[model samples]
Target: MEKTFLELISENQSILFKICNVYFREKVDKEDYHQELIIQLWKAFPDFKNTAKFSTWMYRVCINAAIDILRKDKKEIKKLVFQKSTYIIYLIMGLSPLEIRKDCLN
Candidate 1:
């Protein structure tokens, strides 16, 4: 099972890379995200009931990991500027306008 999982991961490595690219700005951040995704996948493997395709399961795992990382690293954008007049900050942070307004009020 371990060997099979290793082979599967090797074959689908690009999935990890793509997720990392979507979420991370620096190469090191991408690598960290990839590693986190792999760890999450391994931890969740035993309970994978296999109702869906492996790639589908993997994609969900990758996206969840990327989002988790994004949430954690959100404060890293403190120095970056978004036009204050528009909803650009909300858009960049992947929040809906309602969510952004709620956040801002807090």
Candidate 2:
């Protein structure tokens, strides 16, 4: 069971990271979110009957955890949004102008 959970985590680690990135702006906050996610996943794994794709189940769990965290830290929502916007701008700046224009159109 431990090995199975480890394999699932290895395969979906990026999903958890992406969720953390989306929900928490500060590096420290993101790390906290990641740790929280790992703990939640560890606790929830035993009940997972494999009724669906593990990634799908994991994503649902991640989103729920993120939302719960946000609700608990309501005052930080604005800060998180601003930071996420800044990150997006930075990501766009790193892209080629052509890519940026394409992204804008989409």
Candidate 3:
């Protein structure tokens, strides 16, 4: 069972990288995020019952893990920036909500 799960993951590994790329830009950061997502997928593997397709399950797991990471990183960024001022955060990166989501998702 574990072997089968690893096989499925190998074939659809891009799903993991896509999520990681969106959440992290640097190569080191992306690799770290990829490892974390793989861990998340493995932890959730036992509960999977095939109600959904493997890719679908992988997508959900990857997205949820990435979102969780993004949230944590955002909070950290907020903390660091909070010391400076809200004005810099908003002004320095004037990306729209839609633009930000599109950039990440793509």
Candidate 4:
């Protein structure tokens, strides 16, 4: 199974690189996303029925994985920014951490 996957990926490796290039600007991000695409493809291999071309299946899997990663990162960044802004507001309001927690619950 591994050998077959390797051969197919080797032939279409450029597809993964192309998708990564389209999504990421930094070299490290591209490389990391490339690995993520490969892992996603491997995990989804069992579902491949050979009804469609390997490249087609690979493109779908890689694109979805890339989008998911971006969405997760965006969520984390937004959360961090919100926390920082909340802390600043709390400080200006002279609220303690416990008060901040209670306010958040409310």
Q: Highest lDDT, which number? A: 4
Q: How many pairs of residues collide in each model?
A: 0, 0, 0, 0
Query: For residues 69-88, what per-residue lDDT tens digits would candidate 4 score against the true structure?
Result: 99998999999999999889
C-alpha lDDT of candidate 3 relative to the true structure: 0.85
Candidate 3 versus the native: TM-score?
A: 0.71
In candidate 4 the C-alpha lDDT for residue 66 amounts to 91
User: What TM value does model 1 have?
Assistant: 0.65
RMSD of 2: 14.3
* TM-score for all models, in order of appearance: 0.65, 0.67, 0.71, 0.81
Per-residue lDDT tens digits for candidate 3, residues 17-70, read 887778789999899989998899999999998888999999998899888988
Off by over 4 Å in 2: 75-106
Model 4: lowest-lDDT 10 consecutive positions: 95-104
Instruction: Give one digit per residue, the lDDT tens place, for model 1 in 1-106.
Output: 7887888788888888888887788998788778899999998878677798888889998898778777766755543434354468577879898998887788
Error of 4 at 96 (Å): 9.7
RMSD of each: 10.3, 14.3, 12.1, 2.8
Native RMSD of candidate 1 (Å): 10.3
Model 3: per-residue Cα lDDT at residue 95: 69
The most accurate candidate by TM-score is 4
lDDT of 2 by residue, 1-106 (tens): 8998989999989999999888899999999889999889889888787789999999998899889888879868777898678557957679765675676578
Of 2 and 3, the candidate ahead on lDDT is 2
lDDT of 2 at 40: 90
